[model samples]
Structures are given as structure tokens and as C-alpha cells.
Target: MASPLIGITTMNALRHDGLAAVSLLRRYVIALTEAGATPVLIPSAMPDDGVDALLTRLDGVLFSGGGDIAPEYFGGAPHPRIGGVDPERDALELALLRRVVEDGVPFLGICRGCQLVNVGFGGTLYTHIADQHPGALKHDYYPDSPRDLLVHEVRLKEGSRLAEIVGVEVFRVNSLHHQGIERLGDGLEAVAYAPDGLVEAVEVPGHPFGMAVQWHPEWLTAHATARALFRAFVEAARGSD
Candidate 1:
């Protein structure tokens, strides 16, 4: 039997990249499928205003990471090096996230997804972490390396959802994003933080499972705890359906 279908938000590529090219992230898919759910990648700029149709077909939504969110949404000037900030993709994904939030569906956001979730709900972002968090732990540890992993430590909040997901109060994770969370939205709980004291994870108030992690747990291997995070997310999503 097929598993519940969860919507994965994608970044826009081009006419040749296909629709799933936007929302279907590779590690996210592997993580979701490993957790027993059917992963569906919805495009960044879906036609026919087909968002409702996409939501109807989805059991959950995962805002996969890629690109910077256009700063204009949160009343900020764009940074010169803010690469891949697509307005069209941001608009569609924000709309989808809002809808999913209203309905209390299980939602998982990683890196950019975390920023998108916060921004979608009236939060702001630091265009560049180095510029914003001066004297911070230099989160952009790997600037131009072609490798997939950038390792760093994160602090999990006590009695929060993230501590339970990763199965430890604190752990190390891979970091690749230059942008970080600035102002968290109302009703969202901050669950984890980097060594620099940046908010790393968030959970919704009284929700079964609604959380966003600042680091890319997907890129972490030898960590069943990261997989358990998705397992719990998919389980909550399944229960929602």
C-alpha cells in the first residue's frame, strides 16, 4: 500500500526542470520515504493557481532548503550576495505554508524552510549572518567549498520538541546557510540554538508536530536521531490524515 503523500516545496529551476523540480528535495525525499510517507515535490511557481489542488493531495508539507528568501517580504533591502532569492517561488511556498499552518498539519522546515516559515508568519531574517551577528561563531564556515557538509554544534532547548527528536539535549549538525532567523513569530517556540545563540529549531504551540530546524539534518549521516525527527514528523502527519 502507498503511504500518505506529503507536499514538499521546491525551488524554481526552468521549463526543462519539470514541476517537482521546485519542491522535491533529494535528502528530504529519502528522509520522508525512510519514514514511511510518499513525498510529493510541488513546484515553486505552480500554474492555474493550483495550490489548493496541491494541498488537497498532500498529507504534510516540508519546506526544503535552497536560495535566500526575497528580503522585500519582510521590509528589508536585499543584500548584494543574496543569491537565488526567487520572488515567485517565495510567494507560492509562503501561501502553501500559511494554509498548512492554519489547518494544523505536520510541517518540517530545514534551513531556508525555517526562514520561510518565520517570514511567512511576520518574522524577519538576517540577509547575511556575518553582517548581522558580528563576533558570532562564523556560521558560514564553508564559503565556496563544493562539498555537501559543514559541521557545527547546536544547543537544544530543554523540554522542547527538538531535544526529543534528536534524542539529546545538544548535538552537532551540518550548516550551509548564510541567512539565519532574526525575529521569531508569535506562538512559535524556539527549541534549538547554534553556539552563537541563533535560534536553530522552532515548534508550534499545542500542535502535534510543527517544527523547523535551522540546520540541515538531512545532510547528517550516522545519525538515526535525525531520521527519527522525520519519523515523528511523518507519524504526526499520518495521524493528521
Candidate 2:
């Protein structure tokens, strides 16, 4: 059988030369590829019809980590720390996410992707966790920190699909985001949580494989759990085909 084709979202970015571009980190590609799936980058500028056409061909969709989502979409309050807000990316991702969920396409989200899943489903975010979530741990371990550095423990809910795929009840994960889910989305369940009590993972009940995590598992694929997560997603996508 042919490897499943997975559509991954890209963010709006500026090249060093000051030109506009749609970019995605190669690690996401590497993660999906190593898991035996064909990864395709879906830019934010694609029109509704284009996205619709792409969805029909994709076996799975992966929303990657990037900038903070705009506050307007989810009726969130603005914060000084809010940066990298892309209107186009927000519109594209939310629309794409709703479609994928409605279509029952196997999908996985990471970091900002997790937040997107929340906001896409009428839920809100903390905007800035430190200020909004009292006593929140330092979750933004990026730039200076190694991508694979495990910063905190996330306890998985027993019997959750994530726990089943990871084969463990609790594990350390690399933290790389400032915002987090403040309210659980409709039809979504929190399947894991950080030591600080912030939601760390969520899954859509009744969906074939709808899940999202607040960590960078793609960078931590050296561990069996991370690899297993990606493999399970790819296998789910394969089954869909």
C-alpha cells in the first residue's frame, strides 16, 4: 500500500531579505516522513476552494507549532506578549481544522496547533499563561533551550488514545509555548495535563484520531513514545485510505 499523504499547515514568515514567504520547519516533515508518511505543506494563502480540494486528497492533517493566534477569533483579550499573530494563518487553520474534524480525517496538532484546536471549536486561550494562569510554570522554554530538553512532566489520562499510543501514564515533554487552553472546546476532552495543572493535551471524542499536544514531540522522536505517537497517527491515516 502507498504511504498516506499528510497535509501540514505552514505559517506566514518573512525571509531574511524582507520578502514574504510561507514557511514550515523541516523537523515536522522529518517526523512524519520517518513515521512512513508523505508530508505536504499547506500554505495559509490558499483559498477556500483550494483547501477543499487539498482535503479530498490528504489522508491526514498535522497542524504545526508557530505564532500566537489572533485574539479576535476566539474573543480573547490582547496581551503585550502576544506576537506572530497572522490573520491569514488563523483563518486558514481554523477553517481547515473544522473541515478535518467534520470529515473524520486523522489529525494531530502540536504547540500552537493545540491552541488552534481549542479556538477553532469555540474555546478560548489564556493569551499569556503566566499572567492569566496563576502560578503557571515556565512553559516557554525556547530560543535558548534545546528543542529536546524535557522541561516538565505531563500526566496522561488513563485509557486515553495518547496514553495507549505512548504506552505510559506520565512522561516529560519539551515546553515551547506561552499560551494554553483555558477552556475545553466542545466535543474535545483534555487527555493530559502538565504538572502546573495546565492542559497539556486534548482529543476529540468519536473522531478517528483527532489529538493535539502542547509539546514538541517531533523534536523528541528519539524516545519510543514520540515515535509511537507519530506512527499511530500515520497508521490511522493509512487505515483511512
Candidate 3:
């Protein structure tokens, strides 16, 4: 059987030398490759026509972590703490995500990807979790600690698809985002939550395979739970073949 082709979204960046580039962390590629899939980087600035063409050839789509989504996309006013916003990436991913949902393509979203999936489905977000969610633990731990450091435990909902895949009701995950889901999108279910009750994972009901987690699983691929998540995603992509 051919290896499943998984398209992972890239971030938009400008090099110090003054050139535009599409960027994604190497761990994402490594994780997908180790999971038995061919990883393809999808640039954030693809034209609408190109997006449709690209999705047609992809077996699965992985929305990798990146900067914050624009507030306008989710019907919110700009918050002072909102980080760099990429409208192009937001538009591209939203369009691609719609196709993925409509076509039932295997999909996994991480971090910002998770937030995008929520807004794409008409959900709202807490622009800054700590600011809006009182007494919540600090989530943006990327700058001060290692990427693989475990920051919090998320309890998986009983009978959730996520629980079945990870085979654990409670697990540790690294938190590195300031924004979080405030209102889940239509047809989506929150399958996991932190001790503070913030949604940690979500799944679309009735979809063959659609899941998003707030943590960066690519950085924790060594963990059995992380590997299982990717393996299940790859297997679902293989089913599309």
C-alpha cells in the first residue's frame, strides 16, 4: 500500500535576509514520517484555486501550531494581547478545513490549528486565556521551558473518540497557547479538559476522523499517547486510500 500523503500547514515568515518563506517545525514532518505518512508542507499563501487542487491529492490534513488567528474571523474585537495575526493563512486554512470537513478527509489540528478549526465552525475563543479565564494556569510556556515539558493534565471524557485512541482517561500535555476555545463549534464535541475546565481536545461528530488537541503532540512523539494519536490519524488517512 502507498504511504498516506498528509498535508501539514506551514507558517508565514520573513527571513532576516529579507526574503519570504513558508515555515513549519521539523518535528511535525518527523512525526508524520514516523507515523508512516508522507508529509507535505502546505504554504499559508496558496491561492483559492490551488487550495482545492491541493486538497484533492491529499490523503489527510494536519494543521500545525502557529501564531494567533485574527479576531475578526471569530466575530471578536481585537484584544491588546492578541499576537501576530495572519489573514492569508487564516483564509487558506479555513477554506481547506471546510473542504476537509465536507469531504470527510482524515484531519488532525494542533495548537493554533485547533483554534482555527473551532472558529472555522462558528465557535468563539478567549483571545488570552489567562486574561479571560480567571485562575487558569499559564498556558503560553513556549518561551521559558522545553517544548516537551509536561505542563498540565487533561482528563479525557468517557466514551470519547479521543479516549478510545489514547486509551487513557487522563494524560499530561504541554500547553503553549494563549488562546483557547470559549464556545465549541457546531457538530463538535469537547472530548478533554484541563483541571481548570478549559477544553483541551475536540472532535467532530459523525466524521470518519476529525480531531484537534490544544497541545503540541509533535514535540512529545516519544510518549505512547502522543504516538498513538498520530498512528490513529495515519491509519485513518490510509483508510481513505
Candidate 4:
């Protein structure tokens, strides 16, 4: 059987010398490839029609983490703490997500990708989670330590698709985002949560294979649960071929 072709979204970035570039963390590619999938980088600025055309050839779609989605996309008022918003990337990914859903392509969204999936499906987010939800754990850990540090534990819902895939009711994950889902999108169900009750994972019921996690499993490849998540995703993608 041919290896599944997984489309991974790239971040729009400018180099120090001011040249434009499409960027994606190597960890994402490594995780997918190691799990038996061919990873393809999808530029964030591709035209809507272009993305639709590309989707025809992909076996799965992976939405990787990056900048925050624009507040306007979710009908929320802009907060002072909201990070840089990439309208082009947001537009492209939102359109791409719709096509993926319509076509029933396997999807795995991580971090910002998780939040975008929620917003793409008409959900709202806490612009600044800590400020809006007092007593919530500090989630933004990008500058403080190594990416592999296990920062907090998320309790998986009993019998959830995530729990089955990871084979655990509770597990530790790295925290590195400031925004979080406030209202889940229609047709989506939260399958994991932190002790403070913030959503940690979600899945779209009735979809072939659609799941999103607030943590970056790509960086946690050594963990059995993390590896299982990727393996399950690749297997689902492979089945689509």
C-alpha cells in the first residue's frame, strides 16, 4: 500500500532579512513520517480554490500550531493580550478546514490548530485565558522552558475516542498557548479537560476521523500516548486511500 499523503499547514513568516517564507516545525514532519505518512507542506496563503484543488489529492490534513486566529473570525472583541493575527493564513485554513470536513478527510489539529478548528466551526474562544478565566493554570510556556517538559495533566473523558487511542484516562501534556475554547463548535464534543475544566481535546462526531488537541503531541513523540495518537491518525489516513 502507498504511504498516506498528509497535508500539514505552514506558517507565514518573514525572515530576518525580510524575505517571505512558509515555515513549519520539523517536529511535525518527523512525527508524521515516523508514523508512516508522507508529509506535505501546505502554504498558509494559498488561494481558496487552490486549497480545494489540493485537497483532492491528500489523504489527510494536519493543522499545526502557529499565530493566533484573528478575533473577528469568532465574533469576539479584540483583547489587548491577543497575539499577532494572520488574516491570510486564517482565511486559507478556515476554507481548507471546510473542504476537509466536506470531503471527510482525516484531520488532526494541534494547539493553535485546535483553536482554529473550533473557530472554523462557529465557536468562541477566551481571548486571554488566564485573565478571562481566573484560577486557570498558566498555559503560555513557550519562552520559559524546553518544549518537552511535561507541564500539566489532562483528564480524558471516559470512553472517549481520545481515551481509547491514548489508552489512558489521564495524561500529562505541555502547555504553550494563551487562548482556549470558550464555547465548543456545533457537532464537536470535548473529550479531555484540565483540572481547572479548560478543554484539552475535542472530536467531531460522525466524521471519519476528526480530532484536535490543545497540546503539541508532535513534540511529545517519546510518550506512548503521543505516539499512539499519531499512529492512529496515520492509520486512519491510510485507510482513506
Best candidate (score: lDDT): 2
Model 1 is weakest, by summed lDDT over 10 consecutive residues, at 16-25
**Alpha carbon lDDT of each predicted model:** 0.79, 0.94, 0.92, 0.91
TM-score of each: 0.90, 0.98, 0.98, 0.98
Model 3 lDDT tens row, 1-241: 6899999999999899989988888999999999999999999777649878987799999998999999988886578888878888988999999999999999999999899999999999999898888689889997899999999999999999999999999999999998999989988899999999999999999998999999999999989999999999999999996
Query: What's the lDDT for residue 197 in model 1?
Result: 83
Q: What are the per-residue Cα lDDT tens digits for candidate 4 across 146-204?
A: 88889999999898899999999998999989999999998899999988899999999
lDDT of 1 by residue, 1-241 (tens): 3477888877767556454343344777887888899987777667765878877777888888889988889875578869987888888888888888887778899889998888887888889888887566766655565224546678888878778766888677777788888888877888888888888888887876788988777766348778888888888888877
Worst 10-residue stretch by lDDT in candidate 2? 47-56
How much lDDT does candidate 3 score?
Answer: 0.92
What does candidate 2's lDDT look like per residue over 1-241, in tens digits? 6899999999888899999998999999999999999999999998659878998899999999999999998888889999999999988999899899989999999999999999988899999999999889999988889999999999999999999999999999999998999988888999999988999999999999999999999999999989999999999999998
Give each model's clash number. 4, 0, 0, 0
State, as a TM-score between 0 and 1, how close model 3 is to the true structure.
Answer: 0.98
List candidate 4 segments past 4 Å from native. none
Candidate 3 stretches with Cα past 4 Å from truth are none
> Which of candidates 2 and 4 is the stronger one according to TM-score?
2
Off by over 4 Å in 1: 14-25, 141-150
Candidate order by TM-score, decreasing, is 2, 3, 4, 1
